[model samples]
Target: MGRTRAVALVGMDAHVVEVEAHLAASVPGFTLVGLPDASLAEARDRVRAAMTSSGLGWPQRRITVNLSPAGLPKAGPGFDLAIAVATLAGAGVCDPESVAAQVHLGELGLDGRLRPVRGVLPAVVAAVQAGRHRVVVPAGNVDEARLVPGAQVAGAVSLAQVAAAHGAQVEVPAVDPVDPPRSPEDTPGGCDLTDVVGQATGRWALEVTAAGGHHLALIGPPGSGKTMLASRLPGLLPDLDDAAAVEVTAVHSIAGTLDPGTGLMRRPPFEAPHHTASAASVVGGGAGIPRPGAISRAHRGVLFLDEAPEFAPAVLQTLRQPLESGELRLHRAAGTARYPARVQLVLAANPCPCGNAVGKALDCTCTALARRRYLSRLSGPLLDRVDLQLDVLPATRAERRAGARESSAVVAHRVALARDRARARFQGTGWSTNSEAPGAWLRAHPPAGSAVRDLERALDRGLLTMRGADRVLRVAWTLADLAGAGRPEQDHVAQALALRSRTAGPT
Candidate 1:
């Protein structure tokens, strides 16, 4: 009789799974059971090959492997190293007690070498949280695994090394802390507000949006620099705080978007999915278990929906909840899972399908009705949540030939200063930006006088819904802050309201 212990991961999360091996008198074979996915079920072959290559003989008698906590669905080949180690320990070939307090995670190759596995960071974090002080991971994942501060992590190059550590002394190599590559903002893309040439209004809108973390939309014709402006946004935003950077990196890791061997992502992410994306891909869904979609992956960052009106109506509608609540819920028959989606949205759309509706250099081919139908895809509910909307015009030929644009660093400095001020003003409130302030807080601390009355008047005229009124005020406050005003003024309110499209009109 032999018993061993391990864990199984579902998604990036983990749970303890004891892999118990029973050597019984029967036909000589090996069997694995307990709700294992295809990847986990195939671990037997890889484990066997690893053991054979490492000079350990396969247990010839009838064998049964049981993964405990049978209710949870286990997936991934990450269990290979654990399975191999447990099998060897169960067969009495190695001492289990030697690695008793450690959580082991790694895939095994046929030649006995340890291979990198996905979600190593999350697994290590889970192990630390579970009070497991030690974690044995593959060498390639050593840096990623060490992101978990409290966990004592070890790196093994091969299953043979891990096995050797169980009996005779074997030294696992220490992974040096290699700083992850800095974000594009650190290097500073040469684009700048000044380079935008004209469209001063568009640039101001972007500045305010950055200061307040507000969602924005840019409607313009081609060559108007909408995409160019959108790309420069990341540079205008402040560097992510430590907690935010970790979470951003975690999402990228779960999505397998993290660069190989990268540590933590220090800057906020920028995710721009194509317009043709399915609702499942944009908002996250799968037949088995839902995964983080573009919205979730953009947590603590920006989700730029370029060519916004070109997206499917269903997909565009899916963003309403996440835009409002900073989280998205995927409801499946089996369960409901939520992912963080506190992202600043930047949506760019052509004012008309023809890309030249408002009398640009090109003649308009699209009828007014056709243009209205196209823009109407963004439902009123969706547009109401967007805090700022700006109209962009094509840059003049003179501005284009000026051959100079402001560098990202120049705009980034102002953005950082504004963010610091907001943080300082809202310290201890859990609301760092004007856009994040709750309606209750805004009302209680009504921005010094007639602004509240003006808002009430607008609400009375049915110009704003309850949610819309709140978002409008939030935008007003953001506008005032950008001008260095002490409080939101009537002018700021008017500016915010002007930016909002009427519910009855085409968006």
Candidate 2:
């Protein structure tokens, strides 16, 4: 008998799996046990072809391989290398003790070359956490694997090289390593706040959105520069911290969107899915196991949906859970997987289908009923969660010609200061931004009774839900932080309610 270790990734979490090979004194046959998916079950043929091609003749005896923790579902082709090593160990071609001491992670090609697989970083992290510090990965993944601190990682060009290192007296072949399939390189749009010509109200709202990590919605006619304004929000934001960088990096690793060359994702991610995207594509679901969706990919970043009303109602509704709580729990028959869903949702939409229902100059094309039906696609519950809802207006000639506008660098400095104040206030707490503060805590220690009188009146008139009121209070705190106020004053509450109201009238 011979044994070794491997890893199984479900969502962002990685679980350690034990690979064992047993040779029986019976007719030559190969049997694999443990609950492995169809993709994993095919490892037998790949391993056999790779070993024979490497000149490690297969044993003509009954061979059975089992992945322990039989109930835990395992998937993916990353187990190819581990199975081949364990079988070699059982056949006395390598030292079993040497093979058992390290965790193996890679896909073996038919020619015995080691091919890089996704989620190497997380797999190495899980191995290190499970007390196995030594790991062997494909040469293409060496850079990413070395990111894990305290891990003794080795890169192998082929399965023969790995076996040779494990005390097998074999002539390692000169097969070239297979370069990993890197995610398509992303190019920044180079969007800047200066590109937005005018609309002071829209500019201020974007700053507030970045300062507090709040969701926003912009409703206006076409040519109003809604999309231009939305794209610049990320530029006003800050980079991810150490913990957030690792968390975001792990999610991308599992999704196969990570560029292994770039060490860790320091810049906040920005995901803009088309209106035709399906719920599974946007929210993250696949055949056997649920993968990280656009929402998770946008974790600790922004998810901008242009033409929000064009999306399927089902897809838009899925954002409620992630918006309310910064997490997503996807359940499948195999197991339940959780991913971070902390994203700032930016929705931009035209006023009507024809895109002409603006101020009355008799240029409107859509009827009242059609306009209502079109706007109704964005449900009330979803709109209520959006903190800043405003109707963006076209810039006037005077506004356009007005002197220099504030650049992203200028606005980002203010955002940094506001975030620093919030960070200090929320020091030692799990919360970091004003939006993440709990409702009970905000009420327990709130502004003076007179300050929130307007908010109470709006609530009494049924203009806001309990959850909406809480969000309003959160925004009020954010505004206070931006203005360098010690607490929310009456003026701050009034402006907060105004920003929350959709009637932010045509400027």
Candidate 3:
């Protein structure tokens, strides 16, 4: 008898599973136990065929493979290599001690070749966190596994290579790691903010939202540069730091969208799913084990919903939880999986169904009720969670012919400086941005005089909900950070109120 280790992934979480194999003299058969899904239960046939194909004789005896922590639900074919290694060790094919220390993650082909599996980065991280130092993964996933620091990762091609590494005498062809193909969208050269001709208010709102990590909504006609402004928001933000980069990369790895060649995703990810996407696709859910959706993929970045009203109301409402908690908890019959979803949400909507309600031509054919209902698709509660709501009117001829506008690099520099000020103000407070600071904290340490009076009046008049008041306060603090003020002033509060007022009718 012998045992080895493997990782089981439920959503982005990785659980260490012990693979124990026992050989007994009896009828030839194999039994695998543990709460394995259909794909994992089929590993017996894969292991048997792979070992035989590798010229290693199967022990013609009753064999039992038990994946310990047996109550944990295990899915996917990532356990094939671990089960095979443990079984081979029990059959006296390799050194048992050598196999026990390593965590194995890979699928096995019928021909003994190792196949790549998803969630390698998180799995390796789990193994290292569990005090296991070494990991064996598929050659195709070597680069992804290497992203986790301080873990000794070895990439193998076939079962023979794994066995040979454990002191079994076997010869196998070496397989080199290749760069995973990058999609056209993944390639850089994204849109630049300077390309936008006008709509200075919309651009400014975008800057403020980027600076404070606040959510925003844009209402405009079709050609009013709404999508252009939303697309360029990512460019004006800073790159991810080391911890954030790993967290973002792990989400992409679990979603299977990560390119193996690209080691760490330094740039903040931008996910713009079509309006026709389902609630599950936007929030993260599937059949057996749920997978990360666009929201989770947009972790630490932007989730832009262009033509926001065209999306289903139910789907749009599902974002409320993640927007508030900064995490998504998905419950399945098997178990629950949680993914970090601290995303900056951007929503762009046409002013009306006819797309001509706000333009100069005034060609809107829809009646008053139609226009109201069209904008009403975005429920009040959802819009209330949004901090900055701007009406993106079309640029005038003079505005289009104005002098050269500021580039993304210039705006990003300002944003970084403002963010640094916020970081300094929030040092040791466990809050990074003005938006992330708790409302209770802001209430106890309220901003200076007359500014709070103005907010109190707005609240008394019902122009702002209690939640809306807190958001306005947050935006005020962000404005203060931008101006390098010690605290929010009356002018900053006034600006934030003006921005909030724009959302009253249309958004």
Query: lDDT of each structure?
Result: 0.74, 0.86, 0.86
RMSD of 3: 2.5
Write down the TM-score for model 2.
0.95
- lDDT tens string, model 2, 363-481? 77888998888877885647767888887878999888988888999999999999999999999988889888888978876875787787788889998777888888888888999
Model 2 lDDT at residue 484: 97
Model 2, poorest ten-residue lDDT window? 498-507
Candidate 1 residue spans exceeding 4 A from truth = 1-12, 168-195, 331-337, 359-362, 397-406, 450-457, 460-462, 501-507
Number of backbone clashes in candidate 3 = 0
TM-scores for candidates 1 onward, in order: 0.87, 0.95, 0.94
List RMSD in Å for every model shown.
4.5, 2.0, 2.5
| Winner of 1 and 2 under TM-score | 2
* lDDT string, candidate 3, 291-341, tens digits: 888999999999988899999888988998988898999999877888999
